[model samples]
Target: MTQSTPSAQRRSNLKHRAILDAAAQAVAQQGYAAVTIEGVAALAGVGKQTIYRWWSSKAALLVEVYSDLVSRQALTPRSNGSLEQRLTGLLSALFRLYRSSSAGAILTGLIGEASRDEQVRAVLAEGLVVGRADIVTALVQAADASLNAQAVNEVVIAVVWQRLVLQPDSLDEAFAQHLAALALAAGRLS
Candidate 1:
């Protein structure tokens, strides 16, 4: 098969970015349940078939959108403080993202969709769960090699997931501090 030229590739990349942006905007404005391929396509100025060609389902599209949102936010761990302070800062940043933006709603919808769709479940697990755990694990291990990084990562992610799913409104600074302390405590025990 022949490869596309540079200009053609640029056009494709632009369209892809547009589609992701449109999907995110649609979800932010209409919510995940109200979004559709047709709506995203219309918002992106592309045909519905274009969206289908890139993504298999609404869940898949939303996952990409969510991923894009997270990456764009650049939520990596900071290195300017003590371990507990850094962890608390990172957790607080995550909580603020969830409470202040459409990311939270998009993630909640993806979780619900994952329950019923195997493909969605697999994608979510690979795209989100593993990546999040790895980030937390790396942060914990970097700060204190003696800490049980895996357990700490699991607890941090579990608390975040629980709050995101059950008590999103409670994702505040206080909760972030609590979670960070809990992670440190768990790490100390190990």
Candidate 2:
């Protein structure tokens, strides 16, 4: 088989980027349930086969899209603030993202899909759950070396998931503070 030339590689990369961007835009605008491979292909000006070559299902594509969104948003905590302040800031940013953007809708839809699809469930766990838990664990450990990172991570994830699913409208600054405090308290207790 012949190797791909540099120009051909660049074209492929461009198409891949376009597909991802189009997927993100479609999900954000139309929501996950409404988005389709055909629609994303039309938006990206690529054939559906191109997306199929990269992702086997919509859930897989969405997992990558949400991961990209998190990376672009820079939701991690900064080092300058105190532990409480940093945690609060991080939670607040997440809340704002969930409230004002497509992240919330995308995540909600993914969670629902995860229940029925084993592949989606595994991908979501590895990409979303583990990644966010690692961030929270790092922040907790950085703040208090003796604290139980796992405990804090669990509390943070639980609170965030609960609010995102049950009381999304309540995910504001005040709730952020409450969650931060609860995480710290749980860490201390653990």
* Highest TM-score against the true fold, candidate: 1
Model 1 per-residue lDDT tens digits across residues 1-190: 9989999999999999999999888888998889999999999999999999999888878878887887888888898888888888888888888766778989988887888989989888877888557778888888899999988887887778778889998889898888999988998897
lDDT (10s digit) by residue, model 2, range 122-182: 8889878886677888888877998988998889887787777787898999989988999
lDDT of 2: 0.86
What local distance difference test score does each model get? 0.86, 0.86
- Per-prediction TM-score, please? 0.92, 0.91
Tell me how far the alpha carbon of residue 175 in candidate 1 is from the true structure, in angstroms, after superposition. Answer: 1.1
Q: Tell me the number of clashing residue pairs for each predicted model.
A: 0, 0
lDDT of 1 at 179: 91
Off by over 4 Å in 1: none
